[model samples]
Target: MPKRVDHEDRRRQIAAAVRRIAADRGLEGVSLNEVAAEAGISKGFVQHYFASRDDMLRFAATTLRGGIEERIATPLRVRDLLVALLPLDDAGRDDALVANAFLVRALKDPEIAGHFRTGHGLLRDAVAALIAAAQADGDLAQSVDPAAEAGLLLALVAGLGDAVLLGYQTGDEAIALIDLHLSRIAA
Candidate 1:
């Protein structure tokens, strides 16, 4: 009997392969051949989920952005915001690597770039909203400029992600650094 296929599961598996490929190889080198080999699936099977290399990349980008957005929206106390943004372990590092890969790919592809920009804007907006809410509740400092501070928070998150991904810092160190950064924030 043929092996049963779970279409969504297989699709997610393929997307995971896409992230690994881009993480290991530059995005320009990503192809069905390489992805199939990396994923340990047939080349034709890779095509089953994606029509072309671009489709695969786009799907991967969408998936990564969706995940980050979901995490950002998680109902956490204001104090946990920075902690949620910081990658503090193997799982977090892998997720950051995947996120960085998508952002890097966006640098060269217009379609990917648009998605990246939109995602970035959404994150910044969320940060602003959170900060503003905290300040209104008298939980944040009145002196902080929500918009400017939100941008800074986003930059710090990106820097922390890069440091963790590049081995410049361990996950624990990253989390500690983020805590220090958070101490300076209004809320």
Candidate 2:
């Protein structure tokens, strides 16, 4: 009998290797051999899943977006979702590193930039919906624009994540700042 290959699992393994490389070295001059070594697989194996470096990166970006969407899909409160975006743990830090690395590349690559724009837009829309719900429930002020508030919240969280990554502010301090902002917006 032939061995059954889990294609999705193999793809995710390759993406994880890419994330590790991006986090460690900023994704510049990364080769198939390097990725294969990091993934503990052969270069041919990586090629079997991805025909080119750009394809691999696209897969990694999609995987990253999927992760964020999954977290958002969970039945968590608005505060919990905001907290989850912070680099409060090793996994979050790794994610932040990979995301920042890709962000630079996205500025130059239109395809990559599209992926990021779509992901960010979806996340922002979801947050806006949540804010609208809060306003309906009288938790947030009626005068606040849900779309505008969601955009500011997302930008603030992104800035806070960068601060945490740069060691300028601790994760707890960022979270406290977020809570302070939320309190000011409460109805």
Candidate 3:
């Protein structure tokens, strides 16, 4: 009898290790050796899961996007969805760190850029739909274009996250600014 290994879990763990490294030191020098050490697993074990560093990073990016999608999933209010996107907590901060790390990489890597573009488009679409719904219900001003508003709101959220990460502002202050923006746009 041999120990049954959960392959998907192992892969996810390895990806998480990547995120931790990216969050701590950016993604420049991440390697299988470093990832294996961070994951407390053997280098051979990591290679068993990921064929190459790019493969591991792609999986990690997918995992990061999936986490964001989960946070903004159904049954949530528009404000809740927007709030979920901010770096208001430790997990959110970690996600922000990983996202920012990949953002720089996306500048030079088409595959990574594609991943980010798809995620951003999906998130923008979802937010636009929510804005449209709010407008329909008369909670938000119908005078504003939902798609344009969504794009602006997403940009604001990204900027606020950066501000928080850079110590330019606190998370609570960012949330207050977001709420103020929402109030001004209210119906």
Candidate 4:
């Protein structure tokens, strides 16, 4: 009998390799040869999964986005949810690095840009739902607009991650800023 291949699992393995490479060497470092080596697969196998670098990048971005959503899915307060979005620890730092690499590349690639834009929309919607839940639970000011606040919060978190990556701020400092923002909106 032939060995059954878990295509999704293999894809995730490849994407993990992509993330590691992007985190270590930025988007420019990602290539079929490198990802294959990192994944312990052949370059032909990598090509079998992704037709081009852009396709690999799109998959990697989707993988990263799915991870963030999964992490924040647990029941948590609005403040905690906001904090969860920060690149405060090792895993968070890696995710942020990969995200930044993708963002930069997205600026030059329309397909990648569309993928990110769609992911951001989904993230914003999720955040807005969390904000609405907080308001309903009396944990946040009822006057706040969930959709608008969600957009602002996402922007703030993204900016803070950039700052952390650029050495302009520490993760602790970024968390402190987020805490302050949360305090201001408290019910």
Worst 10 residues of 3 by lDDT: 69-78
Count of steric clashes across candidates, in order: 0, 0, 0, 0
Q: Which stretches of candidate 2 lie over 4 Å from their true place?
A: none
Q: Estimated TM-score per prediction?
A: 0.79, 0.92, 0.91, 0.91
State the C-alpha lDDT per candidate.
0.76, 0.87, 0.89, 0.87
Please give, for residues 1-187, the per-residue lDDT of candidate 4 as tens digits: 9999999899999999999999999988999999999999999999999999888888887787766776688846666777788877788888888888888888988877888888889888888999999999998899899999999999998898888878899978988998899778889
Q: On residues 1-187, what C-alpha lDDT tens digit does candidate 2 reach at each position?
A: 9999999999999998999898788888467989999999999999999999989987888777755565567744567788888888887888888889999989988988998998889888888888888888889889889899989999999999999999999989999999999998999
Predicted candidate 1 versus true structure: per-residue lDDT over 1-187, tens digit per residue: 9999898787778888887766566576588998898889999999988899889888777677655555667744454666677666555666677777677777878988887788778877878888888889877788888888888877877787788777788768877776676677644
Between candidates 3 and 4, the one scoring higher on TM-score is 3
TM-score of 4: 0.91
RMSD of each: 3.1, 1.6, 1.7, 1.7
Task: Identify the superior model by lDDT, candidate 1 or candidate 2.
Answer: 2
Candidate 3 stretches greater than 4 Å from native: 1-4
Q: Candidate 4: misplaced stretches above 4 Å?
A: none
Question: Tens digit of lDDT per residue, candidate 3, span 1-187?
Answer: 9999899999999998999999888897589999999999999999998999989998888777866876788634567788899888888888898999998888988888998999999998989999989988989998989889999999999999899989999978988999999999999
